[model samples]
Target: MARTGFDIVRSTNNRGGVDDFIPFEATMRAARAAGLPVGDYIDEVMNGTPGATQSTIDRLRALGVFAANPNTVLEIGPGSGRYLEKTLKECDPGRYEIYETAAPWADYLVDTFKVVAQPTSECSLAPTPDGSVDLVHAHKVFNTVTFLSASRYFFEMARVTRPGGRIVFDVMTETCLDAATMHAWATKGGPGHDSYPAAMPRQACVDLFETLGCSLEAGFQAPMGFASTEVLVFGKGS
Candidate 1:
């Protein structure tokens, strides 16, 4: 199928992310070859200090995300499984699932965590029963999708997460899009990137989540490439 401009841009950006993974993968391979535990290797790479998982947990705890002790936890990417390990240890979920688009990562997640892992598209959670999971999350996943797709993904996240549950996700923000590369890519075949078609605006994402019956708890910036990414934590309404 002929790709549209948006498709081309998204494909190219995704390839760039994948290409950048070479170093991370090579480091892991070398660590394993040297007889280092994979978990320790992952920790060295992802969690030297307050990493994404701990940061998320701290925010969620502040937001009362664990008022009832989450029983089911689902992560969209489970990237390196750093957050997955922390979530399992801290949340003590009864059931765990992960949706990973990359086959190698999916296999690694399944093998390591014994979690139900599947290929996902459109951020769908059909493999999980609706309104069942206590926590549905994705890290650095929404940034790659278009604005409209992000909204749809949010709807799916709301649908699968139980009432009063919590959903967490991160996105590239206006700051990230302001970079020359991102700005140029977003402006390709169109006007200015002020509309932020390639990234979500902070207020816009908050409003959308609010309309989806989620109440914003906290929003913060974390590192992503050359720009800072935004992390949003929301509590679903009953």
Candidate 2:
């Protein structure tokens, strides 16, 4: 039998037999019922942050992410393809490749948006060739992983992006740790997942990408679960 989305969700989120993500299938149902896309439902209803997705897209617009006119796009872990949906409207890359861990979600995105799904891995982009993608990005991803996991992905991101391409991703940084936000995260987060809400210094990220032959083009703040993450855009030198 083919694995259902709920099965996939359960498999990954079965810690202590409490899977908060089993509702993923139901969430898609609700999204259809409300005439909203799955991505919209994840942002506006499930995340309880109406318009947050568009807000980040707007910031991307301001930062000239779309204006670069990329033709080949690669996304890391585009769970519901929320940002990918809008990104298609912005650039309509001819080849939209994705590496998503959730099999059901990857199938959904491939069937729904006609994207190319590559073999998935934990910390490597080995299936994608070096300097092949014009734009590579991950959203709401780094925040939930460990420092080393995020760093490994960062290195791969830079390696696969072509010169003049852009690599975009977000991380929970000191900027998101204002006193109130920190208190809320500490108090409300409630027995948090061990690797969550990873923090990487902004300077370190800038320097790492610089050595990889990319220069910081733009950086900005974007909303995450209950706080914020810093989105960094690095342009590879031509």
Could you tell me every candidate's TM-score relative to the true structure?
Answer: 0.72, 0.89
Local distance difference test values of all predictions, in order: 0.67, 0.81
Error of 1 at 19 (Å): 7.6
**TM-score of model 1 (CA atoms):** 0.72
Query: What is the C-alpha lDDT profile of model 1 across 1-238, one tens digit per residue?
Result: 2222121111112221223222334445656875755544544454343244566667667767666779988887665676777667666787888876655556777887888875476556777788898998887667655566667778888888889888888887765556585755545523432333356787787887888888888777765433456788888899
Sequence-dependent TM-score of model 2? 0.89
Candidate 1 regions with alpha-carbon error over 4 angstroms: 1-27, 33-53, 175-198
Summarize candidate 2's per-residue lDDT along 1-238 as a digit string, tens digits. 1245333343332122122322456667789988988888888887888788888888988888889689999998787889999899888788999987666777888999999988756678998999999999999877766677778889999999999899999888787888999888777774636445567788989999999999998888887768889989899999
Q: Clash number for model 2?
A: 0
TM-score winner among the candidates? 2
Highest lDDT against the true fold, candidate: 2
As a whole number from 0 to 100, the lDDT of residue 66 in candidate 2 is 83
Clashing pairs in 1: none
Cα RMSD for candidates in order:
7.7, 3.6
